[model samples]
Target: MSVPVPYHATAQRPEWSSLPARLRAEVSTRMGAPVIQARTAGAGFTRGFAALLRTADGQSAFVKAAPHAEQPHLVDWYAREAAILTRLPAGLPAPRPRWTLWEAGWYVLCLDPVDGHTPRLPWDQAELTATLTAFADVAEALAEPPVELTALGLPRLADLARDDLLWWGEVAAGREQVPPLPAPARGRLADLVTLESRLPRYAAAATGLTHGDLRVDNVLVDTAGSVWFCDWPWLCHGPAWFDLVTLLITGYATGLDVDSLFAAQPAAASAPDDALDVTLAALAGYHLTAATSAPPTASTNLPAHQRWTGEQAIRWLSHRRGWL
Candidate 1:
């Protein structure tokens, strides 16, 4: 059989923003403006599409889309994101949301874009550290009990978990013509999967809110030094360490040893091994999904993301293998 496509194989392109005209019309009707076109803008992952809209007046607004597959009925992801933004403390860095809607099995959210640069590999540790703490503050304040993601008409963490195991996990395990990972790494992953199987028992203890996906790529820092997190499709309340650990591992894989950087945040650094396991599993699940969806060939743009992902997979395996 041919090699499987990697998760989010399709790059965010110009047309990913092609919402049904009716949706566009609805946008125009709701916003009371004639939208000329919703131009594809910026890179996004794990959702329908994202773009920027140019109104008849030449004003621009960033747009993110969630198709039916992402949300079955209510558009909870979109609603939760809006709620998070609205609840955000004044003066914190994030995009200014203009509107959000659930229409025709699609959830659309529009916000004002902040001009900024996407940080490359080896992220600036000092900048990232401060930004992370700030983000954590916001996330912590926004933390709440788990909401039925599907009640808002979107897939929940449970849905993504099932899809990951059945689809992405199987695909990763089935790669035939791929370069072999080091034996140590291979042995490591086997152990991780075994350990992860016992997570349900510990999961009940990790109650609260989390950003779900808090990696660096999901963040955008503008030229004026403002940071914006674009995608909110996977927002949820769970383990407190979930967001921090995700950021740390992503930071580590990208050559920034976040643990060293955050050596000052002793409280955060003191997270136990068991919590790390859960965080690693969540991160691993994302990597496996990406590996399943991605083609064998690598891309320059996502090197950090891919490298970090690969490294995290090994870390998970090692922990599972009792190496940790």
Candidate 2:
């Protein structure tokens, strides 16, 4: 098989000019200066508008908007992100929300822009270390969900896995098919299915705010080597180890010694062995299932990315279970 590519193909985002005139005027008025220039951001899979804006006075802010007509779900996501960011504890290593607006069928959000770069693929060890260290801090800060946040009706990890982590079941029922697997995995499909079915039980009792989508693209490392996590729409309450395990799956694909890394992480170290296995199975099933489908309209390369990560997850699990 060919080596799978690591990145997804992002759609061209909407430009500033595409926004309604009144909305642009409102953004300028709020910035206290006329808009000087706007450049759309290249990261992320959402087919909405995302850009870096500069005001006449040279102030800079990150802005994202989505028209309800084209992407109603994304509009909801931006609104959800704004709500979550506003409630995050002060001084956390995340961008602060500046403003949010809804006007003329568009949902807009402004945020403080970070001077940082997304981590390189097949991660540099030093950067990976910094990311893991920063994640520990993030976990500690969100150890207890604020009463206000719990009321947002965020989906629990257990509940999410029930629906999302069932690719093998789909295959077993002939609803989906996966590419050929190695001898070890081929024989263990039944075991994989059994393991995945236990996801909810293992995911239960996990408590904390999790960056539900933790990946290299979603993280930014500043010059000072601090990690700033972005894309908060998927924020949910779950075990602190959830995010770490998510990172580890990608890290393993990138050639990191994930076992060593997991041993060093305090949050991960506290998780029961069975819980860890269940999380891995769920993630493997999710990515593998997603990989078998056609790419979504918003991203042409997402299937390849998922396939690569799913392969890594399978390899990682094989090692842990001493599979052929």
Candidate 3:
């Protein structure tokens, strides 16, 4: 039996212990700490549960558990995240890897706790500017030597769905009765899909690892207002614009000045600067799908899938019309 170490006040039990003995052990070992208590962290498709554990020596760590839910190659996806972390460029705000463990046929990720407080966002222009500057710098660093998404055990965007309708449609399937998808919104999605298909060719020419999901919620801002990216489960190798698009969409949704934010980066200056447009289209589809696919959890604010979808489409169209 492993000797029990002193539990830190900051440390708590994992939410999985009530689940099963195997999961408890798995969570403990991966975190390099003993499981004292655990619980649901929030409501997200990929993130189901999280916990705070304390090493016998009093270090607190975080353990996130994402179970496979009909997602193809879920195990491989988890492995890919670990791989991406291993190769993160110097000076970016990504979390440091602690350990990756497999237990009870589940992947358990233990990562060092980032030292920061969650910031009040949609950030002001200053904060958004700083974050984008950092993002552009990282993009440039990765432009030269791109890491393959699959090589790191992650799936490419192509693997995410068989077709645009099948991919985004399924996520919104259950929401047809509530705030039904407007016909114009549906048409817009189809149009975006047509444009997105051309992305592979464009992506091939540009370079770098994409964070895939750059929502402000995934960023940690300390008292000093410095930010760090936390989740890497969706890391991918793709066009530089992909990440910029993700960041811009997040800023736009959260009510920030995305243009000035992105302009701070020299690399982004020459890029198409259509990040916000693309991102709005993608997220409108994504959130609609998520609301349809997952069981209702408290964190999700999507009342009707199509409502979000239409609103997002309008935002995208308005941007295209230069209203933004």
Candidate 4:
């Protein structure tokens, strides 16, 4: 089996000293004291500058900054994340946004500090259970989303899937080349296309709010064994089970009993019997198609990650379908 990809160490962040002097000054001023120490974080996929900043008086905060002039898109994502975090219900195990600043052509967001580490690989049942427990509460709270949040005019997942998630259809239409696959899966391309094409309709029937992006790198396990989620820009209206499947990809890679895990989660309670299979097929097509493109200059490991994720999705689907 391929090793679990190192999700945490893929991000490339700049040192505190390397930030523009004016930006550092503004951040320190906002912190209420002169900055004393900074520790760069290794998690996340963006090239944004994220670090734990300490003040001379012992106060600390996690700060993320992106060069707006250089990468306007990343900066926009961070700004949207700040907006989403502030609107979420209190006490959701997500870091609360403290403030935001713009200086020296950079956009910065500061959040409440969470004393935790990214969940390690070769997944442990205990950690996996903790993560799921945390998400169960999140699912319950978001099951009927608040009117205020819905008012944000968040794009529906079903809508986004129409544009970004229908890679198998593209392949079948000859718009994109078919990616290499195992013999079993290769022979069943038509079935794969059918399964993947159902996601938009399946997701359209749900009303719950989903994290939209829940992977190992987006979660943290605290010292007390409580799990906390991070990153909020991708929040959308979709089936809760969707995030469950995305998060469990790491569990599957570690050889965990993911089928049982999926069966037990409250998030999956409303899922249709074939939801998991449809999701796996859709993901397999998306990742496999994405893996063939040139790696982004920002994250070199992304293609590798896509390839492995696609492979895992296919393997997981094949096992459940008895395609062997």
Candidate 5:
């Protein structure tokens, strides 16, 4: 629960010069004007090429390029994100992907750049309020699943939770080793498993599309103080409160009265009484287990971020359950 470093600052992105000349030319050709300036995005864990490109004729676009020869997974993720963005409702406060193309063994996605910056840590009260309000609008807009959108084969959150979100159960059954824990939380694997295992049952009834990944780094605050969500590869059907929980974890880490803040949001209004506890338990298990695994070749800071997030989750859960 300590004030940790900014997660996004740790990423090592590909420079503009590192991109293939052919692909860069294709981007210029598509923009219909020579590139005048480019500023790389300072956030994200991936090593893909992401930057705001400005043309001599005053046109600007946010471009992301992933090389199939190297970051193949990133290519797949970026391609999937582009496909999802086009189908998202127009009223949502998310950036729209404008176009996508393949050139020189790389996949490229273009989007309209937002005039904004990442929210600062130890979040300003107004910024946090604005973000929560904007996402409430998002939850309202996607309350019901659209046939065309659902037809894209987005996985149901409950199914995903059952498959990949139960690390405590793994440890309880001796399939995975237990990670270090607080003094009071040690030897509580059965309790952790009990809480984490209920996620599927609790999430199964949800029908709305949720932003599967809702971290502070993925959010942008514009000059007008409006919030914009980015990165859409994890979109799925789940209760909107799940996304709210993910966004507010950092708030809790930073010492915000997130319990009350969460209650005030419309997204959490319909959530079950134990919904927050269930999510925090599952998150603690997932991140703690992940922190013990081998780090990705890229994303050097991921392990540290995972550890901090897991500890914060466990701290929140313990306080709520009176584990002390």
Candidate 6:
């Protein structure tokens, strides 16, 4: 009899009824029937509207929308997701795009509905195993980028993390507030900054398609126990073990024996220990820096989530380095 803590809290969702009438009509037209019910999706931090919609004809689809006026960046994200989903290899365990529309100053996407549940926080071992297995399969399946998505111009891990990881240096120079760091991590800020500087070099050898953002909420477990990965906005080209490292950080924070888990993964096992350390440092710096900033519009809980994740990353780094 205890309330379960969510992996991350989602922001308030815009109701299906709140969409403009023209947009609703277009969605109904695409689904081939009038939507009779809409249940808001209870996962993710984006301010965009997402919901499971059922039509009068019993058809169902996952619909997501974001108005350009409110979230211009999200509109681009949705467009990117639509493009990525369409180009994903056939048989990948991800939702298929049914249709996408840009009208009435809103970008809308309809996808094949995935009947699954988000993984529990702290993770159930079996669920975690399934997700890991799926990550490996997906990574292998997407070893190279598809021809259609080549124009996405996804930045390399090195380029993306190089500047973002310097937030600690900014904090040290009094340009930004000190993010909440554990006692052990507080005294080692300089070391972290130094470690972060080497991230690009460590990340340089990475070569493979990667789900840039991998976390508990972005994954789903179907009734048959298969794992389904979602949120393709951050899809990019990076190291084969990139997603695994991200997941292991969360696992480590939740007290899982991530070292053993990493050893068990073929992709992860191939990565050098130093490379993994650099990746962790990069992630820790990025999260810690973003966590200290002002909350993003419509995502009031994002800063808190980022702060918690930053703490976890720092704690994991401290353990790895035996920092005091």
Model 4 misplaced stretches (Cα beyond 4 Å): 2-5, 294-297
288 Cα displacement, candidate 2 (Å): 1.9
Candidate 6 lDDT over residue span 143-241, tens digit each: 767776666677677777665565666766888877767897877878877777776675667666788888777898989899999998888767767
Per-residue lDDT over 1-324 for candidate 3, one digit per residue giving the tens place of the 0 to 100 score: 110111111122235655457877666665556756443433223324455556565667766654454322545655666777777766777776778775555666666676554434445666665676667776777666544434555445444423332234343355332333544554444555544444444444454556666654566665677777777777655555666655555455556555665565555654554544544555555555545554433223433423443355446445654543
Q: TM-scores for all candidates? A: 0.67, 0.91, 0.70, 0.96, 0.96, 0.93
Q: Count the backbone clashes (under 3 Å) in each candidate.
A: 14, 0, 8, 0, 0, 0
Give the residue spans of candidate 6 off by over 4 A: 1-5
- Look at candidate 3 and give me any clashing residue pairs: 13-36, 13-37, 13-38, 14-37, 14-38, 15-38, 15-39, 171-289
- Tens-digit per-residue lDDT, 1-324, candidate 4: 654457768677789999999999999999999999998888776678999899999999999998977778889889999988988987899999999988989999999988788887877678888999999999889889988788888889899788898898899989999998976687888999999889999899998899998988899888888899999898999998999998988788789899999999978888989999999999999989988883453666677787888888998999899998
Clashing pairs in model 4?
none
Local accuracy by lDDT, each model: 0.54, 0.78, 0.53, 0.88, 0.86, 0.78
For residues 38-74, write the lDDT of model 5, one tens digit per residue. 8888777767888889999999999999889878989
Best by lDDT: 4
By lDDT, the better pick of 3 and 5 is 5
lDDT of 1 by residue, 1-324 (tens): 111222234234426335677777787776567877765544434334566667787677777666666443325556668766654446656676888886766787777765554544456755675567666665555444424432444334444444453222343477422323435555444445544543444433444445667765567777766566655646654444556666666455555545444444432443445655644654565564455345422233344455446556555445444664
Q: Considering lDDT, where higher is better, how would the candidates rank from best to worst?
A: 4, 5, 6, 2, 1, 3
* Worst ten in a row by lDDT for model 3: 1-10
